[model samples]
Target: MFLEVKNIVKSFHNEAVVRDLNFSLDAHKTLSILGKSGCGKTTMLKIVAGLENADAGTISLGGKNIDNVKPGKRNVVYLYQEDLLFPHLNIFENIAFGLRIKKFPEKEIVEKVNAMVESLELNGQETKMPHQLSGGQRQRVSFGRAIITSPSLLLLDEPFGSLDAGTRQRMQEFFKSLTAKYQITSLFVTHDLKEAILMGDEIAFMQSGRLKVYKDKTDFINDPVTGVQNEIGFWENLIPGKVERETLRK
Candidate 1:
């Protein structure tokens, strides 16, 4: 396991938010967690990123215990629902921010940022400010900024939740390719069922501060609690004979 979270618990004002969470993720793989709001998904990610302290349990990254490590030293990047780019910075500078924070050599920062911008398909838009870019473009810059530093783990909390349907779909595909290109290990938390299914190499469902990681996609799909069947049923009900057509095709 590249990232191990064991018996993790967190609470606020004596109310438990994450209950005995235990999960492990392999290197260079994405684990998409499907959960609704207030389900402790964001809390779990924050705990893993060391942004919030866990009340109990341990977190290990790359075989080293990081339970006590500071958020900046954890080598984990937590991305929010918003792009959170620096409004004052251009696309290139936004992506270069992390490298600059680490005080990398000027030449190296330029090389790395250039490469990341190309990977993000921003090309000539590097000089443009965040406000000048489309929602998807700004989100791409946000991803590039985080990924440029080569973090050990990336935590994304409903990253595309703000986008329109078309842009969200495009961003999903773009993110998939970006992850593969960077060999990113990420925990993607999304409320969108289809997005969760499409993004994960492994899948899990979170409810009431507890999480259930499925052994495989098939298992996740078959589990009624995940709501995959419900989604299928809804579509089938909307279109008359859709289920019959699927059955006949099979």
Candidate 2:
């Protein structure tokens, strides 16, 4: 495992949200979590990203304990539902922000940002302000910003949820493509079961802050314990017949 989260626990205002949660993700792979809102998914990502402290347990990255690491030192990036691109910066600058903060050479920054922009399909839009881009395009800029830095781990909290259906599907495919290209290890939390199956190499279901992690894609979909069967039925009804085969392929 490249990222190990063991015995993780968290609470808010004395109410337990994540109760002894545990999981791990392999390098260059993704683990998508399916859970409704308020199930403590966001909190778990925050804890792993060093933005929030877990009440118990430990987080280790690349075989080293990062429990005490500061958020900036954790080598992790979190992407939320909102694009959150800098309003003042052009798309290229936004993607180059992290490199500039690290004081990377100007030539290197330009090379990396240009490569990232092209990979994200934002080549012609590099000079455009964040405000000028549509929701999906802005989100692409955000993705470029995070991925251009090559973080060790990327945490995504329903990043495509805000987009319209067509845009959401495109972004999802783009996300899959970029992660594959970058070999990024990510934990993607979402409410959609289809998205979970589409994105995750392994799947986990979170209910009331507890997790039921499956060993593999087949087990994830077949396991009745995770209510995956119900989700499959829903997808079957929604898509007629294609979803079932698509899910099995995933």
Candidate 3:
């Protein structure tokens, strides 16, 4: 397993945000976590990123224990609800910050960063400052920065949550291509079901901090929820289907 999160639990004050949870991901696959707001989706990702320590359990990456690893040492990069890009830095500088911090050769950093900027479609925006770009463009820069470092596991915490629908949809498609291009293992948290199905090789539903893995598209939609399959109608735009409740006649 490239990543393993075992029996993790987190709490603030007296309320537990994440209950005991276990999930693993292999190399080069994307996993999307779907759930409602305040359902601990972001909290769970934070634990894996090493930003917030779990009260219990362990997270391992590539057969090595990472429970006590610092966020920077874990090689886990997180893109949160806001783009944390530095306003003082240009696009290229923002993307190259990680490489510089690691003392990578300038030539190698330029090569990698240029490639990433081009790949993420921020080619001409390299010289632009954060405030000069649109929201979508800033998000692209945020992505470029996270990915340029070649992280062991990429964590996305609602990176597109604030974008307009059209831009968000376009970025979603772009992300599917970009992830494959970089060959990175990614675990993403989103409330958008269509985005989850489109990007993830496997989908996991999270609720109340409990994790449930689905086998495939068929299983994800048709899998029994209580007595009936949990049919999500959010994709009516693409599939054009309606959710019908069929109760047994008495």
On TM-score, who's better, 1 or 2? Answer: 1
Steric clash pairs (candidate 3): none
Which regions of candidate 3 are displaced past 4 Å?
224-250
Preferred candidate (lDDT higher): 1 or 2: 1
Q: Candidate 1: minimum summed lDDT over ten consecutive residues — where?
A: 241-250
Root-mean-square deviation (CA) per prediction = 2.1, 2.0, 4.7
Order of all candidates by TM-score, from best down to worst? 1, 2, 3
TM-scores for candidates 1 onward, in order:
0.96, 0.93, 0.89
For candidate 2, write residues 178-204 as lDDT tens digits. 999999999999998778888888889
| 53-160: candidate 3 lDDT, tens digit per residue | 899999999999999999989999988978888999999999999999999999999999999888987888889899999888888889889888899999998889
The best candidate in terms of lDDT? 1
| TM-score between model 3 and native | 0.89
Model 1 Cα shift for residue 42 (angstroms): 0.6
lDDT of 1 by residue, 200-239 (tens): 9999999999999999877887788988777778878888
